[model samples]
Target: MSEKKEVKDQFIIAYLPDLDNTQTIINNAICFAKMLNKGLILLYISDKAYKCVSITDAEILLKELSSKITGIGFHSYCAIEGQTKDIINKIPHLLSGVLLVSATEDKTNAKVKEKLASNPDIMLKNLYTSRIAYFISSQNLNSNLPFNKVVMTIDNMRESKEKVLWGSYFGRFANSEVIVYYHNYKDEFYRHQLHYNIKFVMRMFDNFKIKYNLHLSSNSKTFVDYQAIDYAKENNADLIICQTTKNKSWFEELFTLKERKVINNSQQVPVLFVNPREDLFILCE
Candidate 1:
């Protein structure tokens, strides 16, 4: 008999800051963890320089939250008292096998600055790691869970394959339908590339026996990310899965990248952002 390979400990990290949307974030995190059949880590990170919640209080809060998981017949760990970057750096496996779920709001206005000072997106960028992240907004608190409908965006870039893989994974695990949106580029070279990507996407989905719908953009001039979000809203999609920018220009850094804009879209749909890396993690059976 062949020896069974041991699966490493894989988990979904839910960043639960001391905010008004704590329960909402927890609920969404639970949904993903359950869907993926992975362990859950309820994480609360406070800067040592500026302590928002005392160590004792943070522990107590985590204890209470962990109880919620247990009640639902799932196990979870509570982590506190470390910087997000340092904790992730310390755990090498976390960089590869973990999925991060956190709440984010539009930080463009003065009103939300104080609340979003410890935003997970900022911490994620600083980690310089390529783990997948799912960002949920307050507007999506009431959205249906188990994500019955998922929207995936594909483009000419090879990185778009990651989005297709993730979408297929979701379809297989959550029994959800994936809606693929691709741009109809007018440029011959780009259009050929787009066709190649779509072919790969179709093949992968068929192999997985996943149900999917395809939509082509009428106007290729519009930004692809925005178009994906618009399609999600029109179709009442429960989630949108797309790739993160591989490189950010100076202007993008200042004005925010396309993925950021999708996360903060006016429609307020939840987004799953997959970093374009060769060694991106895939969920195990």
Candidate 2:
């Protein structure tokens, strides 16, 4: 048998109704679907949710999950598998021929709650369902935006340009102008060197003819982590993109009440953090 190829359909909603805000999930999914001209897949991760349950129970629970969203002339699929996310994950191979509607989520909170601080969720419902259910919607569905601009934030770019190189390929593919922001303190010793680096970065972007923007930071006065957030603000960005590999350790500087104050105050524009292979290895070469 031939392997299935992923579908290229522009927008797809992959929903898990067993999540919180069931009503909101349904509402958002439908709204997004209509807004984006996309298809819907209502998946129930029967056996696949976690490794603890039996298959029989999984199927029963999955079907009873009631993850439904319907609209006139809309293409919707319903599946009660051992695990919903698992099937959704293998969709690239399973639904190979057609285009796929992928759902991406981050384990970290996008906006830190000022009062509650940090604590993990206990319920399966609270953890992933918020966006999973919306994946079924029409409003926040896959983007049709021309992707005319992209941004990058990093500590240093001395040796390896792998991260930027990868980001460039993506921006080039989308035909968007790219901005690379290097966030560091303006120490007296490296003041001159900072200017040179900015010039070099500009040249690299210039060669690509993609039209670039560069930002330099010299001191902790502005906070090292907050410059990108700040630059992203003054520019009024359409999408805030970040790249990382492996898990990032939270820094004391970042987690502190003072630090969170800085980041939390940043713009509310949606952020997109891309996880590329080069992030973990520190392509400082």
Candidate 3:
């Protein structure tokens, strides 16, 4: 007989009723947790008020959920609270590598009676923004999400490159493509500056002639934000990468007009925030 391997004690996951991208999110998180040899906690918080749901009934459901995520242990909590995400916020905070795993649906439009039917994405999104007690609180700690590509926005070399590298590394791990939008907003960079930036990017890759998509971005003046979101939407990108860094300095946070627009308007795609140090910026400075 083989001995059961005990999963590590650092992971935690939440399960919502709607289960929109819940499974997808669950699968992704489990893969990450497994790699780190961690166990997970499964939580289900119902926003729907019920006068008859007993603790035993909820436990049965949780037992079923636990079977699916094998070796990943779980628990269930049913509250009288009516807000889902708010309920999630109230789960006991686990220190160490403890994390909150949540899911959100992509709801571009709202229907009259959404609660009557199940829409996975909408359900999860509702949980995140739910008004229930804990959810409304700032209970969720650091979050780790998978992403690839940064719509790296560049107008002049005013933005620091080292800053967004963490995001780029994430993209690399996902084996995804990154599109850097060089803002020739109204006018192009100094001919030499454009040449250097383009050539410099080549040095970062395998030195192969990696193909890039260039946009003159005519509507940048009035709608750079809209344009960036539209591009990410059209391309099916999971997240838009942005970094803030000090001008004429090495690396800093991704803080600027274009970066801000990318982060703010990234609709379905989350924004990855990164900050790099000065030594990382300079070429052996």
Q: What is the TM-score of each candidate against the true structure?
A: 0.85, 0.45, 0.43
| Model 1 ranges off by over 4 Å | 1-7, 48-51, 70-73, 86-97, 106-128
Clashes within 3 Å, all models in order: 0, 34, 16
By lDDT, who's the top model here? 1
**What are the RMSD figures for all models against the true structure?**
4.6, 9.7, 10.9
Judge candidate 3 at residue 31 and give its lDDT. 43
Question: Could you tell me which 10 consecutive residues in candidate 3 have the lowest summed lDDT?
Answer: 132-141
lDDT score of residue 36 within candidate 1: 82
- Winner on lDDT (1 vs 2): 1
Across 147-229, the per-residue lDDT of candidate 3 in tens digits comes to 44445544345343543343244334455566765444334545456556555664664343333355556554654335655
TM-score of the candidate numbered 1?
0.85
Q: What's the true lDDT of residue 94 in model 2?
A: 46
Against the true structure, candidate 1 has what lDDT?
0.69
Of the two candidates 1 and 3, the one with more favorable TM-score, higher being better, is: 1
On the 0 to 100 scale, the lDDT of residue 202 in model 1 is 91
The candidate, 1 or 3, that scores higher on lDDT is: 1
What is the C-alpha local distance difference test score of each model? 0.69, 0.40, 0.41
